[model samples]
Target: MLKREEVESLVEKPAPQFVRDVLEHPPFRVTPNTTLETLVSYLRKFPVDVVPVFKSVFSDEIAGVVYPHTGLLIKSKKLDVKIRDFINSPIIVKESWKIDNVLEILASEAKWGAVVIDEEGKYVGVVTLRGLLSALLLREPKAKSVAAVYTPVEEKKSRVGYVKAIERLSKIFKKLAGGEVEGYVVLNREGGVAGLLTVWDLIKSRRWFKGGGEPRPIFGRGAARGEGRAVGVARVWRLMFRGVAVASPDTPVDEVARYMATTGLYLVPVVDKEGKAIGAVTAWDVIYAYLYGPKEGREDVEVKRAVEIPVAKPQVEEAIRLRPSRHVTGLRARDVMLTDIPAVNMRDTLSRIRKVFLRTGSNILAVVDDEGRVVGFVTRRDYVTYIAEKSLGYWKRQKGKWLILREQAMPGEQAKVLVEEGTAADVMKSEYPTASPDTTVEEIAYKMLAAGTDYVVIVDEKNAPIGVVTKDELLKAFKERGRSVKVGELMTPADIASAELFSSLFSVIRKINAYELDGVVVKEGGDIRGIVTVDDLSLRPVEESLRGERLVFFTKSGVLRRVRAGLSRLRYSKAGALMALDVMRPFDHATNPDADAREVVDRLLEQGVLPVVGDDGRLIGVLNKMDVVKELARVYITYAMPERLKEAERVEVKSK
Candidate 1:
């Protein structure tokens, strides 16, 4: 329960002229006359998510918005010929316009955010749906309403050693108990929000499982005294380390929050598990989800204000209801995970390790073993501290392999100088944290902060690493993979969770965002069912269709890349055909199964004038790029898009 004034204080008011205006110059503005290739490069270099495409002559007037997706499309085709080719007409509004007016336009457009224009009709800034909602939450409410709270749960927390668990749990209780939540539910093996126990529940309950258990050290010291058996499982695992509540990749945050209110739980785990921990959802996550669009309510209806009286009413008469249809949009792991995340082998050389450390803009690298499981991590400071402590001679004299130069290496010496075992099994941080494929961006961020690790390992059910995540990867995942794909493909889907939608989404997103992937596929019964990208189910509203479109483009690009590769392979094979063909077929010349048709053909053609040398050789089918391309063209034209014009005569045009 929050006071109205308290909520109001958090809401951001309309941007004012006094607001540290970036009016110095509106960053970079592109015109329709700009070449598409140049535009693509421009956008890539610019930090702005969008570049305003203004019409020529007017210069100040915005004609359309050019975003990365559209730019990528043009660039992929080598058709980034001109900006006018891809400009999209966008509805523009002024900065002075009330937030309510902006909301009306957004609802109608079915868009997540809007572009802001200045009085001169020049593009100035953009307003997001969430930014506006945050502002609204600050306004006076009709009444005080009870809502749920959300928190992230680490799917596979570094086996929090017993001692650390106790310490961390103690600190958690001290920090979380007195704050916002009424009572938190402890999730159990069933993946159900079990036991609505609160601080008050602990205080008032008279029964103790262990004989005469004391108040403060609920499970820490008690287990030690009680025959070495773990005691107070609830307090130790559930109470201290919160279990992320479950959510589906498609579950609406409003619905989750409403469910939380009914259950009196703060978080919902978005799991792909049948029944287990995966990812998490929170009250605030839902709030932000709704803040972006109509999925929360009927977003298009306009509000009419009482100008004569001091009344602030929404322009639209849409009702806000917590229902199943209120799906979460603009949220996915792709929106947040970092892209081109750094990774390393467990047995990488110290020199290489040092290079990666210095070269990477990020602070850490995901250290994976031969099997690709994350084993350990190395940080810049870790290396820096080692260098400060160790002598140069100590690293130079005592090593066998060039990869290993050490006078005498101490165990785990200066985290950075240590040799990677190279095997996926060795040197990687096995005792590390993880997030499910469907974990929300916010949840992953919290886990990364709490765990104090930049890289998270994405693992499958058997604990095999699928991908690696860093803070930067998480951001990229949120931006790209957030819309369509699930955690399974995006993450290393594991039998980590029982087959359940909620568990699947939670676990997948957590893993994807934690490890920073496009998104993860949700697994159920040890198979992929759905995909959760950082972008698909998170704060950014990049669409799933956009992802598919991108994949199609990439697939097309891959086809081209693959074809070029095949051609290169063909060229190599062409030169050594005779000798290699003889090696492949040691037995019969006429019966040989491995040979080049072109070489054989040339031999036959030349043999008409000169006697054929009886070399032991075999002949395979002859095909070349020109022949293949010709066939492709014929087939493609035969089945291609229907033409309105009359069919032309079928003629074969021989190539020179």
Candidate 2:
């Protein structure tokens, strides 16, 4: 390790950095078979930022990554899953890449860190996004221009609403996905921004529903008030309770970046004199300021979706009445797109990327130029690869064999200064996924499934990104086309893993990541008693002072009234105490598999997701809004569009 003097000397000399210099040898070792409870304890013990997962204690084969967010989920039992499914793919990089090249990879890829490998592709250590940013930001301190770095007046897009349901928010997500919008904004009746909402909000709500809080679990509840986010009601105001943070068009870019680095707030809403939201800025936009210059234009898309109620022609109405449910047609990618176009100019800097990650919670991003043309793309996976490769370079230079640990939070204050100074053109991937507005729903669906991405950028004749198509948007398009299908035809299977009611909340949360289901069935022996979701696993931290000296356990054998009387005693930190049954939602809200798909979909949108049980009365699957929409799309594609395509092709050929 370098001494402060050495660090100072290296700074003065402008010495190059390698992956080894910043590689963190994950302090904890984990395997596929590790229990959620054990993993939670390990995380608590290690108290680190990220952890590497191996196939097992004895195997060297790498699996995926467990981030800090995972730890928080574990504490709340929202991410109950096995170690295997809980981790994300590790970004890998060669050891020989230069520091600049490595930084480029991390930035363009939008990753926090990566696994390092040597010439033989052997694991060396891990390198991180923060480490790289610290080095760069520290080295280059003159990266002013926060105003220029943010989204231009027209490009900032965050969906703002008075109050809406999860279903409504989902629609916004699909729409804004094209614009590459990061989150949804809830405004007061005065049009003043109240709070922000992202997909993470849903995930957090899932945990909160279970009576869980960060680092601890609270049993005995009636869905605590002020916890926000009402799933049953269409009103959205119930979900947003946090304080709003606002920014203006003239706020300096560096100030915003520093705010993000310290507060973890990546998306800041830009408001006018009346406090109505105009645009939003993210950490990525600030970082891009150092990398790219600016864009000139009025935004080409609507931030709020327009409700264009089409007048029905008598012939069209008759045709619609006569058409089969599966024969729905006439919708295109443009019809479903929000058209905000999520892209940054080529001159944007990489330093402000952390804000982007937090704001959008997405790994993939589109890079554009002054003309709003899509020029490149970036993803977190790419950065992981760069970090891995650079670590080897550092290892070779140091001739060292020790693993670096997160306990030594590095890339210190110096690296950050330099990173704030780097440019977006220095990192973005010139090659990326793109689509055309005229693309059909079926075609777009196949494209997304093939690419394994949720969204695709839409470019115009000049190839400038004008919109995006996402799974959510595709679902919206299909629903508007209308459909009649059986619930059995399109539900996501709930046969994913389950945990006993008595299992530690850790075990239930573990199943979340391990199985990839938003929620899981809770069983008491052979009988299903309840369901647990990530929403139930989150809570505002308990006032530790409210906790008593001893643990209080709840049992079903006692009368409900008696148990309710003794409810206040349970109290402790999130990691050590808590069980799945404690955070599981009671066996309420379920539907029969034979219900009409539309009814099921309406139920999903109106109330919330529910379990689908077979005639035998066993939980078989889940019917959510997405499931209904996906089925709608699949049916239309199978029976409706091929002939439409053929007829259109015939017309084109005749014209030619």
Candidate 3:
């Protein structure tokens, strides 16, 4: 837990100036005509996760940002599809805006990053979550212990045995997707921590399948061709990555956060002296600590100090005056409720519900009767759970037939058939929470959180569903409440993985996979050499393709080139012979520990990770986009609706 003095000091820090002070130059932008395959290859080679889309290479007006992971999930052979087809509107912010205001905007927008423009609306650069976190770490003072912030193991309730069958893992995953559990802690035979699993691991495992379809088996000499067979019968151990980074209860919160940010692993298991998992610290836990201070009897002091410091009497009075009233003055269910979400009938098939969800992008839908009165609620998670349970039943009754059916079924037809067999009534929750059209947003938020439901139906006097309010709408209503916050108050301490320059490619790959890292810093004795990332390895695509595998070679001019090699020869020879320097790129991006957080945010927007350097130019820490977003979310929840936080705390305690 943070000492009283430390908490006070954090609470008193002043906000940074404006967005212009930390503006970054856009690293690279692409035209809308850029192909998905081209973008994938570019992302593989570069560290950037999102690329800004312009009408053309020379045009100044922005289109949107393209995230490559979504495109990677496309199972179709149409790699030549234009990026315009995958674009999402970018969150636009101005360089002249104050830092507090911009922070509120980004937090409310809930995007990976926001695009920055000048007074003339000309693109200047981008500010990303990573950059925000890097900026925050630069100004951070004393650190707090993980025990002060980590969610206890008992509260997670998503554990699995390493040897559990693949069929049984789906239920736990469904819980995770539904927000019923935080994450899964995989335990070994002796009950020791074996590994960790999250939704990302599931996504990564299905990368070979296009659009959640059947696996495409690759055939070649020395190539593993039984991937389809393995998927059917593999144990949890096959999907869970080992060598997970762990933390003790006493470890500093920032240290664990830094490891998570840089390594791409969000949850770190908290183990005891006996190496048994006791609890877990996630990015959210760390952010909550930064915003409201430690959970161990210190939040009162922190919240009081934070509220009194930046907010003046007039602002507080105004806030109180503007608070939602039962009679009038603020938004109610009718004002914020979404009326366009599709409704399903009790007799509707899961297949039709799935189609409606896909078409509308709405997670929650109302189940209505022939009279148009809502009887229950169904969610995307319900459909997912139903399919998983159905698959498990099929595997138990006709394991041989199921495997044969899977192999013969068209890409998505088998899954469709499973859903078609079930009706909406089979998975609907009849006791879902509901609210009147006149209910205030405050009441609605409290109801949803307290009831552990994502949405509430807004019904008419006759009990007919008219509109619905989900967490998103509630958040949107109070998005502008955050103020006087800075990046320094949110960033974690830097702790990253490193390897020797002479390390074999095989050893490096093993280390990367074990830690689930995007890359590692390669160094010589007492000196830094370069960095190597998953993009440099190019193992996934090569392993998936039946054609010749490509080996990376650097020219004398330091340019990277790919040379095709036979699968057998490449597999047997390169593992031991190749070295880190053979594929490593020169490390160029670095930020000062004393610089404004915006500078780091700018750098991070351009580069996936930023290395923090001290006055002496030695590496101090690293920051990534995921950790920054977690911090931003903390700011959003705490400041946007301060009055609701106390009730939220009660809900969390009761749920535990």
Candidate 4:
């Protein structure tokens, strides 16, 4: 409806902000020759919501822009395809075109977003529907709040002139007395919005940068480099075709650990309705979550649980039950352990204890005196060193015979022969990192990282070992905590059938993810055996497609395909039945696809069954089995959850 002259005036009045003005251009533009793996790095570095794909026709002019979201060339599993193959016509708009016209065109097409040549048919700045909408409806807090505007690294402040945009936002907020704009998002030289400098963002940034504390060189440098490369890479991997696995707060403790070991993901973002990211569960957090998490219903939790144990000394079945009694205890040291016991003495000759160690193969040998208290703990590494030092003749002479001696060994000789050695008094590190039984799994993890140890002996108020914490035990705890709870009570006979251990890891993971339950129970012949946690499932590796990692799958009316990484906002189907909104929910703020395939695995671990939705809101691929596991390792630790969840329900809830 606008005339050319008017449009020209509009474009010219604003003046064409060169690519340098708005584009972030730090790592520079990627060419068609770039590989997809490298391309993925580019996207991650820029942090640009999307990256710009380009084909060079000449030295200066761009042939077209590749919509990284929709472009398959960037995601081709082949990794050898020329990036130019994915090029689409650039959605160009002249700086002179009225913003209103640009809006109108975007609205009409609904499909197209990028605008290329302007009314004068000359190269102009690019514009997207969401960005323009954000610009036009600047006053709508909800809209702006929901629709965060981000630019690919190749198109950030360095490429285009967004100084004007920042100025505008600044002025509006200034006029409103610091109340108009929530905060201004600034793109770094590479084009991605480097960080949300919201008032909150500003506070956090200042605290981090200006705190005048000892600095971690690696963290600081990597963070800066990451921001610079964010923009270019942002748009490049727009599709984020992969899926996520998730679980609920109430999932069992053991199952979460299993998922982590199996899936190998560091964290899983927790979400709620509206698909907003709420909180996150990391591998370490899983252990603490289970130990410190509320256990009103989990009173019977344990590892290597004793089955059919005679409560009152019934007729012994083969003298004794070989099964180690499983005991679910609190998070701290001494809460779930046996304390008083005779222990190996470091002063004794290695040969004397070798027989005992050979018999038990217990990794930890607590060195104590006649008082029956722990002095030092020698682990398997120590014994390995002792064996390695022995002459081959000694082993050959001994053969299967056991040797026992208590001869004195020099301190220096012992130290040289032990992998890690100390006297009963010196070698015993804090047998138990002091903590209450009520401590949560989240809290225990921080303590472990700080203490630089994997094993934490649980203790009572009296500082005795009620339980022992080890890497394997924590792994189980992490797996269990990641599994959310089911609508019904667990531990009941009827509920035992719904446990995950009875089903394939994939199916249980899906149930944990779909139903948002804790963990699935393992059942052997209708009896609860063990459970698979989110971490266990997440750590399990699976086969993948060529493009990138596949998060989940979809099958409706006989179609099955994997989810891609960059195309998080899209759903692919040969049937052509999926809608844009379905894809958008996972990426864009409007739809809020809170849980991805990774998160779904967490859900399945908790619940016995998972719920899925596809076209017409029908169930699609259950996201069970090896499919979701394919992309498990790709998940990172610190990525923020979706922004649309209630505070009390997310991972942050524990922090708060």
* Candidate 4, superposed: residue stretches over 4 Å from native: 1-60, 66-89, 94-101, 107-112, 115-125, 129-656
Residues 1-656 of candidate 2 have per-residue lDDT tens digits of: 98998899676545336766555566668776665556656643343334678877786678877654443233345435576656777778776776666666655655556778888888777765544544444343333443344453354232232333334443453433222344556665655556665433433343323434333223334344434233323234554433434555544455445444332334666665455666666655655553443434321221111121222212212212222345554777788865643455677644344235334434355676788766766544332222222221111100011111111124532122211223456555565557788876665654554353345667789887777775446655655665556676666666444555556544444444333334567665446776655423321112121122232222222322211110132221111123553345454467877776655444453333567877777777776444544454454455656677889999999999
Q: Which of 3 and 4 is the better model by TM-score?
A: 3
Name the better of 2 and 3 by TM-score.
3
Backbone steric clashes in candidate 2, count:
91
Deviation in Å, model 3, residue 7 alpha carbon: 32
Name the runs in model 1 displaced over 4 angstroms: 1-26, 47-49, 56-58, 75-80, 118-123, 128-272, 275-656
Candidate 2 structure, TM-score to reference: 0.35
lDDT of each structure? Answer: 0.36, 0.48, 0.52, 0.33
TM-score of 1: 0.26
What does candidate 1's lDDT look like per residue over 237-277, in tens digits? 43322212234343334444434322223344443324333
Model 1: ten consecutive residues of lowest lDDT:
574-583
Better of 1 and 2 by TM-score: 2
Candidate 4 lDDT over residue span 283-372, tens digit each: 323322322342223222222211221112122222111222222223433333334323676565554454444344333556766776
> How would you order the candidates by TM-score, starting with the best?
3, 2, 1, 4
Tens digit per residue, CA lDDT, model 3, 1-656:
99998998688544335676555543556888887656655543333324678898888788898653544434434435777777888888898886556555654444445778989889977765434433444344233666676666565333321222233453454454333343477776555566666544544454333332345355753236433322233356666644355666666565554444333344677777566667777655655554545776532211000011111112222212222222212667888899887789988865566556644556677788888777788865445444433432211101001111111121112122121246788878888678899877666665564454567788889876778887556544543232222333323333334566556555665554433334566666535566665433332222111123454645323466565533321221110123564445555686665555543554554444555556676555544332343333333234444656877999999999
Give lDDT: candidate 4, residue 585. Answer: 14
Model 3 clashing residue pairs (backbone): 75-210, 131-600, 131-601, 135-597, 136-487, 136-488
> Model 3: runs farther than 4 Å from truth?
1-28, 31-33, 76-82, 97-110, 141-143, 152-192, 196-207, 210-236, 264-266, 295-656
lDDT of 4: 0.33
Per-residue lDDT, model 1, residue 113, is 46
